[model samples]
Target chain A: MARLLLLACQATANTVENEQKSMQVAAVDTSKVSTDAFLKNRLEIVRVDKKELPDGLLKVQVTARNVRTGFWTQLASWFMGDNPYQIAYRFTWLDIDGMEVETAASTWIPKTVIPGDTVRLNAVSPNPRCKDFTLSIRENDAARG
Target chain B: MNTKIISLIGITSTALLLTACGPSVKRIDATGNEGLVTVDEVDFKDWQIAAEKGINSLLASGVLNRSDGRKSILMISTVKNSTMQHINTRILTDKIRQALLRSGKVLTTTAVGGNGPDDMASKQVRRLEEDDMFNQSTVQKRGTAIAPDMSFSGEIVQQTSSQGRMRESYFFFHMALTDLATGLAVWEDNVEIAKQGKKPLMGW
Candidate 1:
């Protein structure tokens, strides 16, 4: 009985560790826009565009393309190339001093897109002090929150 | 009681007890994917999504940046809720206000607005000029308060339809920023959210 309990505890710990790793790996920064998402292997970041508007706010537009796989790899019988993934993204604004500039709209925004399609996420600096930004992308779980 | 009635009562009590032993409450990221969602209601995540979309549109419109090279003064106006749900409109406006403030392109007037002063202290402090307890030199002058260059207003509308056992809802967030002097909308945008779920047999 004691040995069984130890094994169960180890299994629980492993599950927790896997969850943490998945969440951490899910976030892909714009600086590493070339890298694909570890959270969902199908989603790939194709292009990243950054510019300053007339009002001196930094705007970053990230384009992500979804790559599709077979039914066996997806683990589903239905495979018509229309499978959609709910993805969430958040933007963090950093000032000249490298401090985060918090805005009320700094919450994650969720979007649903099908594989073989592209998702464009755009965000502007909430403050003029924010000269730099970091974008985090992850899979959105609607009912989990 | 009949056997059917007795079984019904026993099942109801057991269900209630099970519900009472539901999961414990815990804090989660408000903007993340873990928020509660209802097919017919405007959830917190919905408001967040709408507010961010509205802010992005407003900023990208370039209406806040005037040709005079000065920050525009803005007044917060009423946002009519035409939806069935009772929504605290501030949850939507406050986010836009905060983002605009951070952008440094617009300053919201607290002394005057469509619904009157946001901060009553603005007027109460100025009223001290009439009082003798304080020096009148430090008091705010009448002409010192600047008028807003633009007015912000919006409406939340919803449309619902049922198809078989599934119910679908579409919420539209329509917002506009008007030029106070020109009396014309300088910028306008709309954000829409569509959700469909299996309809419950009972209450909404």
Candidate 2:
């Protein structure tokens, strides 16, 4: 009788564990990140070597630094993997006379920013017609994956 | 006379014994091994690291997105070998091409490269046949040129310095992706690898 009762208890415990796991899995949401959070992590455009790209392409480098530091909750960082950090940048183009070119090519690119590290992102404009430009940066949380 | 003979025998035996005991002891040159050796030349590991960095930079910069509709087509163009030795530049270029293709943002030439397209001659033959049939059937026959959106070109340069037995080498690899239409480079990267060695020794 005791053995049977123990088996029944084990079965109940297994069912509860599985139900809890399913709940956790169901709670996970693969949603798009927020724009404000994205902007906060982005790079601050310090300076551009040339403001205008004559040939529709501009050669410029953006300087960015990682300013976040703290004891990580996922604490195997010393051996398993590094703390995640990302540099997100976007490029806005313009015509020779200085007008925004709203095209599909304008999108954010995520760059790996090492922890407590500063990086420079260099770019050469590929669009021959793009003359003036604006560059923006945001922090990327996608690097954690 | 007897004493002289005995002396000669004794001297010869002693000389033989001494010669046998001192079997040509040559010193091992340990100046190179005296300390940790650094390689001054670009090695396999260096190439690996540089290639990785270059790919990362290219991906991060979103240079390939410059094509029409944020989609770009790439072709493996000229990769100049500026180094002393004859190296197949394809090894490095191929890796870059593969990575770019896998990134889902860029498309590379699928045509097999012989003097024509496709790795297999049979596939090229089939494609040609299909094109010919299509051309014959169409009222307005037009030839579609498979022009690359961007052409990749680069060079690898190497430098070496030696002092006595110690040696150092540095290799710089520069790469650029230029738009075929405008003759403008859309992406450019430089990777430097340096190594040092005391002397030439063959072991990993």
The candidate scoring highest on TM-score is 1
Q: Best by lDDT, which number?
A: 1
Per-residue lDDT of candidate 1, residues B1-204 (tens digit): 699999999999999999999998999977666778888999888999999989988887778877878888998898889999888888888888878877788888877766677888877888898899988888887777888888899999999998988988999999999998999999999999988898568875
| Global Cα RMSD, each model | 8.7, 20.5
Error of 1 at B173 (Å): 0.4
- What's the DockQ of model 1? 0.57
Q: Model 2, stretches more than 4 Å misplaced? A: A1-145, B1-42, B67-70, B112-123, B126-145, B200-204
lDDT against the true structure, per candidate, is 0.74, 0.54
Question: Lowest-lDDT window of 10 residues in candidate 1 chain A?
Answer: A11-20
Q: How much DockQ does model 2 earn?
A: 0.02
lDDT of 2 by residue, B1-204 (tens): 999999999999999999999967666422111122236434444444455567656765656665256567787776677777766776667777776665556778755331344244434444554554555444332355355678777889888888877777778999888888899988899987665666646543
Residue-level lDDT of model 1, residues A1-145, one tens digit each, is 7544432322110000011111223333324442232334657767677777877777778777777656664543123222566567788776666677878787778777666788888987786677666677765545211
